[model samples]
Target: MELALPTEILEDSRNKGVVTALYDALSRRDAEAIQQILAPDLEWWFHGPPSHQFLMHLLTGSNKDSSSPEFSFVPHSIAAFGPTVLAEGFDPARSIAWVHAWTVTDGIITQVREYFNTSLTVTRFSAAAGQSDCSIATLHCPSVWESSLPGRVGKSVPGLVLAI
Candidate 1:
């Protein structure tokens, strides 16, 4: 008769695969695959620097070519923080984003967050892609104000302000 492992062991094993897959997808710049693993109602919150803007700048190849600074995760350790999985890694060049993910219910990832030094990226790309600093991406988030406003206020904000 086959035997099943304990729940904790199974969960932990899955965590490793999930973390590895995330890194692989990101390095390959596979946005579709990245979105696929996340839950449909995913709450992806970002901190540190504006990666989206950075990506745009990078792809434009004015600041940096589409190719990112080659990075590979040197996993230091893995731990579960609340419902989130934290994979600590050391990137000698500090080029890649450090990811944190919170999964809830049926292996569905509910939230995801990433951190990285934008200044470094901007500098690196500027040198590599041979373009002057067009505009360094800022970290301010419009969502901060939106979130503070009353719920459903977003629906009203648009109608209230008619562009003349």
Candidate 2:
């Protein structure tokens, strides 16, 4: 008899892939790939200094050109909890630190919360016990999670705390 992975595990793995591939595409400045991975009406939120909004500037730039990227967000560690994926990196020399919280839907990334030069801690709030029901919106039923981050082209996952 073969043992299959649980649905949540499969989803978590897939979500990790989607977010990882996005970084690869972004590094390559591949507009076509970025467009394919991101949803049209993507939701976004950012916290930190106004000057460190490199990702925002990149995303808002015209999609017409695959110009060289101004900065890189190469996360040292990436973790996926249900539909939410967190990537963190830090640069000590430049004093640059960041974290990205991504929400993926049906293999497409629908939302992202970005942070710069901030510490983040993700807490898990599960539903009442004995709950086995979960909807698409609440993919990981009984489990509501939140974050926290770090680092560089140099890889550092700083100030990111994941609570189970």
Q: Which tens-of-lDDT digit does each residue in 68-162 have in candidate 1?
A: 55345544555543344655444444434343434544555666544342111100112224444444462222211001112223233221110
- Looking at model 2, report the run of 10 residues with the lowest lDDT sum: 143-152
Error of 1 at 109 (Å): 1.9
Q: Mind giving the per-residue lDDT tens digits that candidate 2 earns over 75-118?
A: 88899988889898766666777888899999999999887766
For candidate 2, what is the lDDT? 0.77
Query: Model 1 compared with the native: what TM-score?
Result: 0.46
TM-score of each: 0.46, 0.74
Worst 10 residues of 1 by lDDT: 118-127
Once fitted onto the true fold, the runs of candidate 2 whose alpha carbons sit more than 4 angstroms away are 62-69, 128-164
